[model samples]
Every structure is written in structure tokens, then in C-alpha cells.
Target: MRLVIAKCSVDYVGRLKAHLPLAVRLLVLKADGSVLVHSDGGSYKPLNWMSPPANMRTLSPDDVDLETGVVEQWIVQSAKTDDRLIINIYEHISDSSHDLGVDPGLIKDGVEADLQRLLAAQIDLLGDGYTLIRREYFTAIGPVDILARDAKGATVAIELKRRGDIDGVEQLTRYLELLNRDPLLAPVRGIFAAQQIKPQARVLATDRGIECKTLDYDAMRGVDDSETRLF
Candidate 1:
């Protein structure tokens, strides 16, 4: 968890005031070495992308509230247009010294990395072709933290939460609807992964045909086992 505070210039301030807020910054690692900016948190905005439109940049934040100076976090999950990489930005907690009532690991950036690690383990255990997709926007329902998939070919839309209320069944469902609507993702199935789960969310998932799993050290250890399903 590294907290990087870029020096604010007049142009930067203008962009922040116009497009986002001034919170902390965070990032989510993507499959092709690209990253996603889950939340601008007012910390930083206007990130760069190296692709065909090389030097391409995006001003993070869906919109801004000039009156309150509060810019909502941006959600750019799985922005890969092809075999290229994408980068994510968000607020991050550098360490214990910066733990302002928030668990360092819970930071969107850190959580995304953990999700990547967990997914990597699962990939090792399950197989390759499965990729990590970062999701960080709060829709009409709630926030979607990450998405996992065998998406190079098939879809396995996994929504993740590092902490907090486990009443994510509805949230997951909403996201599933979004994922399903996309012609590229219509074949996707839904999976919910978190450090913990609520009884109600579990029951709802069972009733809705959604899959839920928990991340534990054992899951990581299971990687490299010959029993793994690798392509």
C-alpha cells in the first residue's frame, strides 16, 4: 500500500475541481500488466494509458460536486480493449502509520492486489485463462470490488469484497445483470468471494443460482498441486 500524492498544479486543481475531488489515490492490477483506477478519492485524477492512442489519459471520477468538493470514486473494471494492458488508480493506505480507522488491507488498491493473488492461486489450482477483473463502482445497489473470469474465452464474473457487510447478494445480482447484458460477457456466470459471508447473502445466492466462495490460506497453498486444472 503506497500513498502517492502528486503535486497539485493549477491545471491539476482545475481538473480535480471540475472532474473529481481531492481524496487519496488507489489502483487495481489487471491481467495484461495494466492497472485500473477503482477510486480517485480526490487524491489524483487524469491517469495515463499506453496504447494505440499512446499517451492516452482518462480523468478519473464519474462526476464531481463542486459545492462539497467531493468527487465520487470511478469504476473502470477490465478496460482491456484487446491483448493490451490497462492501469487503475485509487486511494491507498501506505502502512500502519496511515491507518485512519481503516484497515490497510481494505484499501481498494490493496484489496485488488490481494484479489489478484487469490485469483492467481485459484488459477494455479483451477487453471489458466481465468483472469482478474477489478470492479469499484457503487451502482443503484452497492459497490462491486472485483471480477474474476476465464474471460479470454469464457466469462466467470466474480465480485469480491475484502470487508464489511456481506449483504452483497443483491449487489452481485445487479452486477450480474450488467455483465450479462454485454455481448462479450453474456455467457458469464457469477461468483462472490470475500473474507466473510452473511447467512442471508449465502441463502440468496443459493436461491438465485450464484456461486460464493471464501478466500483462505489453504486456497493459496492448494496452488501448484498436481491436481490443479491447468490449461
Candidate 2:
């Protein structure tokens, strides 16, 4: 990973367009080929970013750019789309790089942990011929709940939740974004599994091309009726 604090202006072009005026900002260049622009505010979300499957090229400023004070430029092109992010650097501050290895993923609480176990055992619930690759498929960002292969052998990342919400969908989206960086899983699909799913979450998941499944906890636990099991 590379981190640089610089005074730069940015512009994004593709399906939509946006611009960020010159200012001091943190630029993150991840090992997975993603680039993120962040400011001191906005918490953890990047002010602007380009996901993986991208390539970045640095070019010296041209004559016109020289008039505007652009010393250099970084052009990040997305391989999956026509989207591109252009950063025109005016001043350099600090730069550093680090090799952060794969993350072990977040520790699960009891219910989510139990849910993961149940879903992994009944991987077929996803579909016919689905096979479990493994649980806790670790990536640089975090671990996937359960990695599996579909009938066609494509990769699927299952995100288990006790109660599915829009937040879970966002979390799964992040995982999918990072997972797709791997050539072995370039076109990974996502499954948002939970005992209960909110309406908004379903809509967002569908929009993002993610499949949703509601788990019958009692059935998975071998209880004939849900009433027979105590919370």
C-alpha cells in the first residue's frame, strides 16, 4: 500500500462526472490496484476512489497544465468500465508505502458465528452443485464469511448476518469490490444471508446484483418447529 499526502485537484469521468478542487488530501494506492482520495474529514469513507481492476499512469504536466500549476498527473483507468479518475498534483507533502498482508477478518459474535456454521454445512441452499471453498476466506481488507463455487464453478462470497440491513449490503459490496481484484475470482457474486432481511436491504442488494436468502434457523438447528427452540 502507498500513502501520499499532497495538494492536488481531482476529476472523475465516466457514467458520471465530479471534481475536487486543489487541497491537501490523503491518497491511498492499494496493492489491489485501487486508489482512494480522502480528506481529514468524512470519517473512513473516501472522498473519491477508483476500485480495483484499474491501472494508474503518472504523466508529467503538459504546457496547458503548467500554466494551471499542475506539476504532474496520475490517471487511473478502470478496466471494468470507462471510468477514470485524474489527479493533478500541485505540491507533494509526504509519501510512504507498506506491505500489509491479508487480514484475518472480523471476529463474529455467537449468533453470526453459529449462522456461518449452519450455512456452510447447507451450502446447497445457495443452489444445486454449490460447494464450499472455505469459511473466513481472508483478503487484504477482511475475511469473507464463506467462499463457495456455484454450479458453473464461479466464485460466490456469502455474507452472513443475523438480521440483514442496508448496512450489511454495503459491507458485502466492499468485500465484493476487493474480492473481484483477484483474477481467480474476477467475477465473484455475492449472497447476503440472514435470518431476517429488511425491505430496503433487499432493494439495494437486488440493485447491486446480489442475491439474498433468509435462513430458517430452527430448521438448520434440527428443531421441528421454531416455537420449540428458545431464543
Candidate 3:
């Protein structure tokens, strides 16, 4: 990944239009061909971004841009569409790249791991016709708990928690954002499931268009089943 801290302005042209006035921001160019513009605020979400497998080209500032103090500009064009993220650089504070070798993927504790296994085995619990794509689906960021397809064949990212909270929702949101970048999964939806969910978390999940589901551990463990009963 290449990380650049610079003072620059940004613009997006395609599907919709957006503009970010001159400011210092963290621009991340991931190995996966994802370009993200992030500010000090907004926590983990990027201010602007171009998803993979897009290509980037650097162009010298034109007459008007040079007059505006732009040193150079980067044109990041999406391969799937005409959407573009343009960055006009005025000053550079720092720039560096790193080789973050193979990732080991995220690890979960015993309960979380078991829950993941159970869910993957009985994915139908998610919904009728829900099919499991894979578990621990890795992306540029981290491993998604579960990746599946709904009955309609729409991609769905499921984040599991023993106790669901706002943080869990935010994590799922980031995963969804990255997954939707892939043309194969451009319209990824999210499901936040846990044994117990806080009220605030549920509200936030609903507001963010994520579906919240409550897990029943006892039922999944088959505690009520005669087959598991002891005389």
C-alpha cells in the first residue's frame, strides 16, 4: 500500500458529482487497485475513493490548475464504469509505500469461531434460499465474517458478534463498502447478527441500511432437541 499525506482538493465525476475543497488528507493507494481519500475526521470511512480494478494516471497541471497552485493531478478511472476520482495536489507532506506481505487473516475467539462454523453450516437460517459464498472473506481491509448470496443472488456480508454494538455495525459498514467496490459484488448488503444487541446499535444499524438479526444460541446448540438429551 502507498500512503500519501498531502494538501489537495478532489472531485468525482460519474454516477454523481462530489467536490472536496482544498485540505490536507490521507490518500491510500492499496495494492488491490483501490484509491481512497481520507481526512483526519470521519473515523475509518474515506472522504472519497475509487474501487479496484481501476487504474490511475498522473497528469501535469493544466494552465487553469497551475494558476490554482496545483502541482499535479491524479486521474483514477474505474475499470467497470466511467466514474473518476481526481486529486489535485498542491503540497506534499509525506509519501511512502510498503510491502505488507501475505495476510494471516482475522482470528476469532472460541465462541465467535464456533458461531461462524454453525452459521456457515446452517446458512439457511439467514433466509430461505440463502447460500453461503464463503467465510472469512478477505479484502483490502480485513476478513469479513461471512459472505453469502440472497435468494435474488445479491451479495450479502454478515458480521457476527456475541453481543452486537455500534462498533460491530461500523465494522460491517466498512466491509460492505469494500465489497461493493468489486463489479462482481457492486450492490453488497449487510447483516449484523448477535446473541444480544444493544438498543443504540440496532437503531444505528437500521439507519445505515443494515439488517439486524438476533441469534438463539440454545437452539443452535440443540439444547432443546431429544437427540442431545440425557436420560
Candidate 4:
């Protein structure tokens, strides 16, 4: 990763126009060729960012840009789309690079992981006669949160999220696409389960023919309590 703190201005041109006036900000260049411009505040969301499958190049300031006290510029262009982000650096404050090798990715924790475990044990939450095959079912892309079979014995891929958003739907869609390719799981269907699902996510999931299930964490735990053994 490369981190640059400088006095700069940013402009984005693509599906829409956005501009960040001259100010000091942090420019993050990731190993995946993505770029993010961040201010001091505002949680983790960057002020502006270009997703991966993009390119970044540093160019010397042109005469016109030099007149404005610009010393250098970085052009970030999307490889899959026409999106572009241009950063004009007037004064460089600091720049550094770190050799942070391959990331292990995020670690699931808290209520989310616990919810998965509970749901796996109580697969009937999905529907009558639903039986869980496994949790964290492996896939070439990643692991499906839960794999199960419905009442009619149809393979079902369940993606559990704390908050169901469009991204979660996209994730389940990818898993279903891959799983359905296998003759063994050829007819796999998708169920997007979450504690709270956004309206947009529900619409997207419905449009994609994926079932949207709102999970009741407390109620599920209550059901588990009733089924617990004292032995």
C-alpha cells in the first residue's frame, strides 16, 4: 500500500461530475490499483475512491497546471469502465510505501458469526423440512455462509448478513451462479437471510429470484433455548 498526504484537489469524470477543492488530504493507493482520497474525518468512507481493476499513473505537471502551483498529478482510470479520478498535488507533505503482503481478509465476529451457528443448528428457520448440509461451504470464489436442502430436497444457498444490502444479494448471486454449475448442485437456489434488510436490497433480491428472509436473532435464540438439553 502507498499512502500520500499532500495538499491537493481531486476531480472525477465519468457517469457524474464531482470535485474536491484544494485541501490537505490522504491519498491511498492500494495494491489492487484502486485509489482513495480521504479527509481527516468521516468514518472509514473515503471522500472519493476508485474501485479495483483500475490504473494509476503519476505525471509531471503541465505548464497550465504548473501555473496553478501544481507540482504533480495522478491519473486513476478504471479498466472496466470509463470512470476516472484526477488528483492535482500542489505540495507534497509526505509519501510512504509499505510491503504489507497478501491480506488474510476480514474475520467474522460477534453476533454475525453466532447467528450463523444458531441458524445452522436450526435450519428449519429457513422453512419446514429444511436441513443444513454444512456451514461455510467452500467455493472457488469464497465460502457460502450456509448450504442446505429445502423441503422438496432442492439445494439451497443461504447468505446471512447482519444488515442485508445490495452487496449481500450480489454475493449470494455469485455463489448461486457457481454452485449451479456443478451437476451435483446444478439446481441450487438462493436465500438471502439477514436481521434487517434494506428496501433496495429486498427489491434486488426479488428481481434476481432470490428469496429474502428476515431473521429474528432473539427469537431464534429463544427457540434454541427451548431445545437445549440439561444432560
Candidate 5:
């Protein structure tokens, strides 16, 4: 059976009124479902709430299938059958150069372009049928930093950590767990890409059977890309 995910569109103008990045809070099969999300690195403590289409009914937390994990279900059902999965677990838009700099759109475009190029260069390295999907996709599993597909159509989730943190590894682990149990996308592999990696994070990934990789990028430097090889 083919699965399809509808494009998510929140009433940005009429609602929240804040530029908080729109995120896929949670994944539920029923039309009437609630999404749960919280601030990053904050003391929010993962609060779950009900927020769905007005016409749709509210679904209990148990209504969501934990089999595939919430994030995987959301992603698989949200994208078109032929579309690839590209996730960005941590996303931020700032008018400063500390991060990707101002212009969220520009940052998004640049990152997407680089990923496309990287995939193209390693076409042979990557399994067949692999394709570049979306850019800066904010999902319930944090930001789906980057999710790819293999020749067999299995997902390869990528998590990018700008700065190393124990939470980053835990978050990615959660995503992997979700994907592993998902019947629709079982056997999905995972990749952990980061600018800097914590020692503990490294050990955690190795213990969990994930391929932890290091990605190097010159910060605020105008360079075509000094180097981006994975470790």
C-alpha cells in the first residue's frame, strides 16, 4: 500500500503571530489528532497538547501508534509516495552570523543546495534510488537535520548537531527508535552529522548502532566549502 502525507500549512497570519518555526509536533493516523512540541534547550519538559484541524476531533495520546514512533509515522504519512524524506532536527532563524545568519529562506536554500551536491558527488557511495528530499524540515523528532532513502526505499535519517550536546544524541536516538519499529519504513538506518561532537555522544551512538559522523563547515567564512567529508 502506498502512503501519502499532506503538506502542513498553519495559519501563520491569523494565529500565533510569532515567527516560531512551524514544526510537525507529532504523528497520528486519525484525522483528528494533537501535535506536541516545546522550546529547545528550555525547561519546557516536553509538554503535550491538543491542536488539530478545527473540523477534526481530538485524539487521545494513546490513539497514536507507538509501533513506528511518532516522528516516523508523521513523516511517512506526510510526504507523497515518491517523495524522499529530508529532516532538520534543530532549526533556528536569527538575524545574526552566529548561526547560518539572517534570511531563513537563504539559509534553507544554501543548505539544500549543499546537500544536493554532496549526494550527487557520492551517488555511487549512496545506495541506488537515493534522492535529496526537503531542506530544514522541522519535525517532532527535533529538526530532521537530514533524512535520506536507499535503493530499497528505506529511510536513512540524519541528525545535525551544530554544537555537541548529550540531548542531541538522545533526540536522534528517539528518531531512530521510531523509524525502526515502523512497519512502513522498517530497517531504516540513521546518520549523526555534526560540526562538533561530544565524547559521550560518540559513545552513545556507537553503542546504539548508529553511524556517527563529523561535518566540518567554516563559520562565517566566505569559502566555497573548505571541506565536508564525513568522519
Candidate 6:
């Protein structure tokens, strides 16, 4: 990862035009070729970001840019779309690179892991007569959070997330794509199970023919007297 603190202005042009005025901000260039511009606030979400499969070029400031006190410019262009991001740097406060090495990815915390376990034990939460095949069912890409047989006896791949978002739907779609290729699981279906699912994610999941079920975390954990809700 490369991190740069710079007094820069950003302009994004593509489907929309947006601008971030000159200010000191953190710029992150990830190994995947993604770029994110972040302010000190807004928690972990970046103020602006360009997703991967993009190219970036550094160039000297033009005459017009120099007159505006711009010292350098970085042009990042999307590879798959018309999106483009331009960073106009007035001054670089700091630049550093870190060798993060291989990442182990996210470690499931107690609640998430426990939720998986409880759901695995109570496979019927997915549907009536659903029987668990396994938890952490191995796949070539990664483990499916839970594998089960639906009431109809079809293989069902379940992906559990603490908070379901579009990315979670994407992940489950990939798993279904791979799993359905196997002769044994050829007709595999997908279920995106989560505590709270974003409205946008629900739309995407439904469009993909994957069912979205919102789990009651407290009820699933047996801590709350309220009935576990599934939809």
C-alpha cells in the first residue's frame, strides 16, 4: 500500500461530475490498482474512491495548472468504464509505502462465528426441512458459510454476513456460479443470510434469483426472547 498526504483537489468525470476542493487529505493507492481519497473524518469510508482495474499516470503540471499553484497531477482512468479521476496536487505532505505482505483476510469475530454456528445447528432457519450439509463448506475460491439441502432436496448455498450489502450478494453469486458447475451440486441455489441487509443489496440479490433472509442476531443467539425473524 502507498499512502500520501497531500494538499490536493480532485475532479471526477464520467457518469457524473464531482469535485473535492483543495485540502490536506490521505490518498491511498492499493496493490490492486484502486485509489481512495480520504479525509481525517468519515470513519473508514473514503471521501472519494476509484475501484480497481484502473490505470494511473503521473504528469508535470501544465501552464494553467502551475498558475493555480498546482505542482503535480495524477490521472487515474477506469479500465472497464468511462470514469476518470484527476488529482491536482499543490503540495505533498508525505509519501510512504508499506509492504503489508499477504493478508489473512477478515477474522470472524465471536458474534459472527457464533451466528454461523447457531444457523448451522438450526438449518431450518433457512427454510422448513432444510438440512445442513456442512459449515464452512469448502469451495475452490473459499468456504461457503453454510451448505444445506432445501425442502425440495436441492443443494442450497448460504452465505452469512453480519451486515448484508451488495458485495455480500456478489460473493454469494460467485459461489453459486462455481458450485452449480459441479455435477452433484449442479442445481444449487443461493441464500444471502444476514442480520441487517441493505435495501440496495436486497434488490440486487433478488434480481440475481438469490433469496435474502434477514436474521435476528439476538434471537438467533438465543439471548432475546423475541422470535427469530426471517424474510
Model number with the top lDDT: 2
Q: What is the C-alpha RMSD of each candidate to the true structure, in Å?
A: 19.4, 15.3, 16.2, 9.7, 22.0, 9.7
The candidate maximizing TM-score is 6
lDDT of 3 by residue, 51-165 (tens): 9999999877653445467888999999999999999999999999999998998875437777888899889989999999999999999999999999999999999999999
Q: Write the per-residue lDDT of candidate 6 for residues 1-231, one digit (tens) a residue.
A: 999999999999999999999899999999999999999999999988899999998877553445468888888999999999999999999999999999999975545688799899888877798998999999999999999998888999999989999999999999999998999887998999998899999999999999999888767677776744354
Work out how many backbone clashes candidate 2 has: 0
Per-residue CA lDDT of candidate 1, range 1-231, in tens? 223332121111212222323444344332333433334543554343222322224444554322233222222222343222222234334422233454457434336457646665465333456665544534455555655566365666566666423456776777888767779567667777766777777777878888877665444545444446473
Clashing pairs in 3: none
Write one digit per residue (lDDT tens) for candidate 5, span 1-231. Answer: 111222222222222232333463322222343233343445655322234432222222365543332222232111213221222222222212122234445334335346434534453334457765544445555556566776777678777656656777788788878767778666877777666788888888888887776654442223544556353
Per-residue CA lDDT of model 4 for 1-231, tens digit only, reads: 999999999999999999999999999998988899999999999999999999888788553445468899888999998999989999999999999998899985436798899899999988899998999999999999999999999999999999999999999999999999999987999999999999999999999999999887867777545345573
- For model 1, the superposed segments whose C-alpha errors exceed 4 Å read 1-113, 120-129, 132-144, 163-166, 217-231
- Candidate 4, residue 125: lDDT: 82
- List candidate 5 stretches off by more than 4 Å: 1-130, 136-143, 151-153, 219-231
Model 3: which ten-residue window has the lowest total lDDT? 59-68
What TM-score would you give candidate 5 relative to the actual structure?
A: 0.39
Candidate 4's C-alpha runs over 4 A off are: 62-66, 110-231
Off by over 4 Å in 6: 1-110, 227-231
* TM-score of each candidate structure, all chains considered together: 0.38, 0.50, 0.51, 0.51, 0.39, 0.52
Superior candidate under lDDT, 1 versus 2: 2
Tell me the deviation in Å of residue 209 in model 3. 34
